[model samples]
Target: MTGGRLSHLAPDAVLTAARRVMARCDELARVTADEGAITRVYLSPEHARVNRLAAEWMREVGLTTRQDAAGNQLGLLPAADRDAPVLMLGSHLDTVIDAGRFDGIVGVLMAIEVVRLLRVADGDGWRSPFPFGIEVAAFSDEEGTRFGKALLGSSAVAGDWDDAWWELEDSDGTSLREAYREFGLDPGRIGEAARRPDQLVGYLEAHIEQGPELDRRGESLAVVSSIASARRFQLVVEGEARHAGGTPYDMRRDALLGASEAALAVERICSGEHHIIGTVGQLEAFPGAVNVVPGEARFSLDLRGEFDGERDRVWNAISRELDAIMGRRHLRWRAREVHSAAAVFCAPLLQDVVRAGIRATVAGAEPATLFSPAGHDGMSIGALTDVGMLFLRNPDGISHHPAESVAGGDVALGIRALAEAVAHRGAERG
Candidate 1:
């Protein structure tokens, strides 16, 4: 019952499934808030539309579909034993502002395709079932695009919903609770989305590498080693504003100059460390007039690493450097912690299954292994179940932008590997 012996997974069938996934991604891309760009957010009209479309596709493949109270779309195919715990596969469906088509969309569609392939593989036409049930979840708010807090949907599913989040608002100033009501979901019933430990086997997700490692090595797929530990901050620098022309260079305390130095320090320190990344994604200076020196400056820092201690160490180093820069410039600076998540390592059993699945595709080649720096719904779902991920090659590793791309051929191989992984997992359970 190894993945290699799954005779029904022929090349033509896998390619057809891949093409369908690509087409479905295109279809989902159109159901967005912006007409010209993809911008679907949580609990919006676009969310409802995509859920309906996903449900329709789920039903077509003989799955029992439902939208949970947290607005996640779910579909289930039962096991031979009706009461058995289920193995789940899926990723988020929501998109960031002007997002690429396949960040989370492909995983959901690929999960559906896997189910279809499984049904075809089962010669008895649903009579012969696997040892565990299978479920695909299209989580509603992984991007946190509207609310500014990521993993809202998966956190609810993981039973980690925070009451404080109810007060969180979008750019339009609409609170989460109000949006929930508007989306036809009762805010109080969101707890129903949570799943207890005994009711599941594990979770599996497939996503684009979102980095150049795979594409650089000429590899089509890889097994993820772990998701990185991350910390985000909003940093502010303060100084006295003065007339740019009137003030002498020695007397001027320029906050913008201090902030720029700090940004450069982040890159310098992080570049010297292995697997540690630092990004200054946003920056702004106040009273932005050409003749006036900036009185204050604000910037964001997103720092991540393979381990928590190393990440914090880099942050501490960056902080020291920032202090030196501000002191030398006669300015003051501060940082506010906005978000944090611990590293999540993949389960060994799941990793083995994924490796076997990849072997089924490439025959003799060893699957490349990588650690993901990008955050995902799995970071939240890991609280509920063991999580494993497979990475598809993304050209140039571009993601979260209009230019993100994945090849149809690579997607075809991803489908076969994912289906084989499910089969291998089933055999293990038996």
Candidate 2:
């Protein structure tokens, strides 16, 4: 049997199964240190516990399982075709601080439940086309909580690294080196985590929408077309600080004025591009006092878009505005780029499977192709493998806080759609 012979699970069945699995996962997800919500943030100690539990779950479902050096937990059903490729369904379990319960929790467990139904024949005699083998993964450390980095584990799996990668640390000053030692993982073996490009036919990640598109329309699954690249910059304005009472407005070279003008320029540029967004998230001034003029003023810039050209356009426009502001104010200013990443789109081949699965689950459900305003762990994996993502509807159209949500039915829909896509890849391998 090949990997593409997917006996797609019914949407309702996957939903019911997901609810059960989520309950168990939530128990394991509880934080002892901060007993707040049930969000799954990856901890070195908790990771070992989850890895062991996942292996047991694999055994219960009759699949072979193990953990890799990078702490990724994988459950596999050996392909009938000994040399056949693998179909992967996964998502990170970690979450943002004080996050909602469903963010990344459902995605990982949903994969497990879907694969379980396939191996067991769903009691309705609906067996997957490739019942001989299917796999689920609970990848480690996508959130990069212990360290300030994001998507660390996935980057290592893609075989891209630099000396700077190991230099990352958390707010408490725990470096990646210290994290590895504390977690019982080897920093030296990080390079060994890369997978053979040929071995993985495709990767599918089911994630929360973290936006209101789905809930607003009452839909369940969103087939994401592209992942936006976020270009980061910092603008610094240098001005002469003087006594507020003595310094005349006409004689002042004000950095705050430059900062405000640059901010307006960024706002104006956003009007031209629908997907482009720029934010001045942070601002700081030195020698601050009630009566003193700010000597040095600096602010952070965050810009993002679906294409590299669009990202560049917004950045250039912002720079143009900054230059104008500095010239007008007679103030010296500098712009520095903090980080840059190229935008990437998902595999259309797998996206087709996602659409089909959604349609099969929801009667008259219009499966829409939406672009993610933010990036995901899957985008990082795009460096090494063909990957696609499914977004479950978010109730509030917001995320990274306690307000995120998803309807039970919608979450179930995403799970079914993801399994269908994974099964399609398995069938293709055959």
Candidate 1 ranges beyond 4 A from true positions: 1-4, 120-128
* Deviation from native of the Cα of residue 270 in model 1, angstroms: 0.6
Among the numbered candidates, top lDDT falls to: 1
What digit string (tens of lDDT, one per residue) describes model 1 on residues 61-157?
Answer: 8788999989999998888776888889999899999999999999999999999888633443341157788999999988888988889999999
TM-score of 1: 0.96
lDDT of 2 by residue, 111-185 (tens): 777777666443432233362445577777776556645677677777765658677777777777777778788
Q: Number of the top candidate by TM-score?
A: 1
Cα miss at 350, model 1 (Å)? 0.5
lDDT value, candidate 2, whole model: 0.72
